[model samples]
Target: MGEKLKLYGFNNLTKALSFNIYDVCYAKTAREQKDYIAYIDEQYNSERLTNILTTLTDMIGAKVLNIARQDYDPQGASVTILIAEGSMLPAGETQLAHLDKSHVTVHTYPEYHPETCLATFRVDIDVATCGEITPLSTLDYLIRSFDSDIITMDYRVRGFTRDMNGRKLFLDHKVNSIQDYIEPELLRRYDAVDINVYDANIFHTKMMLKEVDLQNYLFKTDVYELPPKTRLEIMNNLRREMIEIFSGRNIY
Candidate 1:
């Protein structure tokens, strides 16, 4: 745990956490792919996403000032919530103007490849705050909120705040790596990597599930129904898809 720094005034350091979570599935037919996408759209619609963000806002000890959410046509959804420190604001003070600067947002992307029969649903979330409250506390809850197969996260602290003696403090807390904040049990379930710039106060972590249960990745398809050879092929294809996404490139 890092010691709390006694700041000269309100801590203006902006700490932001950005996350990308992916859920992959194998949909054998066109209908299955369409259905998979539709299912994701409904499962994570604006209403649901707003709930998640609001919960996250509470976890970080912030108050939601306003919310803007929309469910897109065909597929996808987006939710944005403006937040402020838990303290009550002065009379006639409006927090709406800070919507663009300090807020929690989430957007979903659900798509599939017709030829490959691989469907992927991606959720991008961002939490930015400019005060004593930090978004790091909500990491565990956010990770467990979705069926994440691969996850990439970036956390950075920007700007500077003054100490009692007027010395500048770039980061109020210590962060060796983003992985340090994740639960050890959760870390054991996945292979994780880190790319951090300590001087710049930037941290990045990417994770991919190490174990694959065939039935879990199949959409409306029974694992036992497929022949042994077919099962092996499906498993390989799924693994390949996960690898491609984890590496952020086409395997070939």
Candidate 2:
């Protein structure tokens, strides 16, 4: 932490944070796969997602100007909130298409392998602010809101704000790595990697949970029901899938 810069005008610097998470599941039968999707849809529907974003808005110390939410056909949901850093917008002027300051959005995908029993629930969230608010403050809370096996995050500070003396400051605060903001307890559970471009003000971090328990990945099934060999095969397939996702490439 350092001394706050005295800005001449509204802090024009824009900081954006994107958080993405993957929850893997093993649904061995056709019925199980259907149930998995159904469960995901229910757990993260439009209503619940909106509630989460509302709490996030509070966490970042921003005011919600407007919100547009929808639950898609068959599956998935989307919620977008237009926020303000200071005073609320003039009455009767609330629309997202013209918003350029602060906002929060969430998109969910309930998908499964075509030929395999592997299923994955993915949620992508973006929180961008233009004034004094910083999205990094809400990182841990957002991660804890989901059931994650793998987490990938990207944070970038864009544009510039002027100091009291009219000098342009690219970044208002100091941040060497996104990992620095993550809580120690959560950090201990995952293997992490960082690829950052400090000069450009962009930082990326990806993490994969270190421990894998078969029961956690199984859907509507138990380890005791499957033969020992089948259980081992399931565990291997799950591990391989997780590794490939964490590495962002296929394993040959």
Candidate 3:
């Protein structure tokens, strides 16, 4: 029978231990007072802990594991080790069982208009299950349903500004996203555009709003407001509906 083992915390460290089964223990520098490695050792038995850590590392496909003492630890340095006995677990089948909650505070820039309180909030969604859909795909669906115009927007990939004929010009273009495009363009107009895009793994979402310089008498304004609780509730409902739609399909 396959052994059922569980290990908690220790981000990439868990994966490293699984691959280097020979390494009995390892240490991770603590960010604050929370020593993750020490915590794991305190929680589980030595043998079971070793098995679980090894399994998790194998499942995640790690290369070499390292041990480091936290620089800010008041109690001094501590090392963690693990031992492996069997083959590693499959990486693909692993699912995120839980997610820690985090919050982002919005601050207005000096140029921001005080009449309109604009705030940018970002929340990360951890994948708890492995299926046909990925986190990025899910985020795309959410963004598309939320705002379609966001997908196609002109942006400045790169370039420099010069005072040509007392006019500020920016060389820009309509690109898919940040990483995918890199070019330059010159513009004689000033406009503010707000954009939101997902990162590579859909692990993080980046939102940007900046004013472009132009020499035209006409001015354009773009504003983005944080969604209210009601809108957020609706979004949650929509996500649930989408999940139900995909779950109902029969692959066989």
| Best candidate according to lDDT | 2
lDDT of 2 by residue, 82-180 (tens): 998645455555533324568899999999985669999999999999877898988888888995999999999999989888899999999989989
lDDT of 3 by residue, 1-252 (tens): 123222222111110000000001111122211343333234333333334333333443322132222222222222232212122222467743322211111111111112212111111112221111111222323232222111222221122233324332222112243323211121111111224332311111132212211111011211223246633443344333323322334332
lDDT of 1 by residue, 1-252 (tens): 367778897888999999999999998999999999998899999999999999998888888888999999989999999888755433465633342257999999999988778999999999999878788888788889995999999999999999999999898887898888888888888999999999899999999999999999889999998899988988888899999899999984
lDDT of each: 0.88, 0.89, 0.23
- Top candidate on TM-score is 1
Worst 10 residues of 3 by lDDT: 14-23
List the candidate 1 regions with Cα displacement exceeding 4 Å. 1-3, 91-100
Residue-pair clashes per candidate: 0, 0, 16
> In candidate 1, residue 134 scores what lDDT?
82
TM-score of 1: 0.94
Q: Candidates sorted by TM-score, descending order? A: 1, 2, 3
In model 1, the Cα lDDT at residue 130 comes to 87
lDDT of 1: 0.88
Off by over 4 Å in 2: 88-100
Candidate with better lDDT, 1 vs 3: 1
